[model samples]
Target: MSQLGKFITIILATSTLALTGCASKNKKSQVMVAPLGVGHGGNMGGYYGGPLVNNSDAIRNAARNIQGVVYFDFDSDAIKPEAARILDQQAQFLNSNQGARVQVAGHTDERGTREYNMSLGERRAAAVRSYLAGKGVNTANIEIISFGEEQPAATGSNEAAWSKNRRAELSY
Candidate 1:
């Protein structure tokens, strides 16, 4: 065979293999060149193997990737941008897991009177709950509790402890 012909055949084989990699993983391959609506024809095709995977599985995976806790600045109940994005991911999972319910417990550093600290804690928890709700998670699926200064994540009299204590914990 001529050298140019052999090169053309080699190139065509390489192109075929590369394009094959782009095709869906389904073993039933006829759907590749099938027309639009003809893609899912019973015997001829399957959108995704045997059965549809549970969407909740994806949601659970997303939930697992995110830390369920959100921290706040000193004496602040505002959800920071970074915190908001994590909460958004949590909200997506919560919305997907229809049977899932969670508790958002608010905590505060030991600086204010019990009454004041309790109020602050509640505000923090409520702030997280409200954010999740705004992101489309059912508010009814979330329960809010205020721990005030009772539950300190890190115990100390310093800013590190204060920062650690001032946060909301999401528990399943």
Candidate 2:
């Protein structure tokens, strides 16, 4: 063979080896992707040859076992006395389970504009997250989301319904 032929063969072999190396990498060592608040933990490693576990479901179920809802007054992000009690329980669970990741979802009544409601929702969620962090829960493990009036606990346009709608819910 000519010198050019030999050089071409070597390059092809190197490229093939590199591609094979990439394709054969261990999937177990790779991090798994989950939802916003669900961190990459638990038995998340699985591929065609391994057993796959539903980690997001597991995390959410675990978190659901506690007091996961806190109510707020109209147009207020302030933590009420009752809300503080609920947060205390949530914080204790989070502190005990350091690996647990929590998502704080804030919601508002439909009395305001969408933009204003969204901002209020964010403040409510942030307030809950802050309270949990103050109680020694890791802030990194907490995620906050604002649903505004999009997700309401109650459907009617009355004070009773609005009162129920103004709240934050926790999920893992």
Which residue runs does candidate 1 get wrong by more than 4 Å? 1-65
Tens digits of per-residue lDDT, candidate 1, 79-155, equal 99888988987888787787676767787898998778777888888899889989888876777777677667787
Q: Looking at model 2, which ten-residue stretch has the lowest summed lDDT? A: 43-52
Per-residue lDDT of model 2, residues 1-172, tens digit only: 9999999999999999987776555643112222222222332211122222223666667767788899999989999999999999999988877777776778899899877887898889889988998999988787777767766777797999999999998876
- Alpha carbon deviation, residue 64, candidate 1 (Å): 4.5
What's the lDDT for residue 21 in model 2?
Answer: 78
Clashes of 2: 0
Winner by lDDT? 2
> What is the model-wide C-alpha lDDT for candidate 1?
0.73
Which regions of candidate 2 fall more than 4 Å away from where they truly are?
1-59
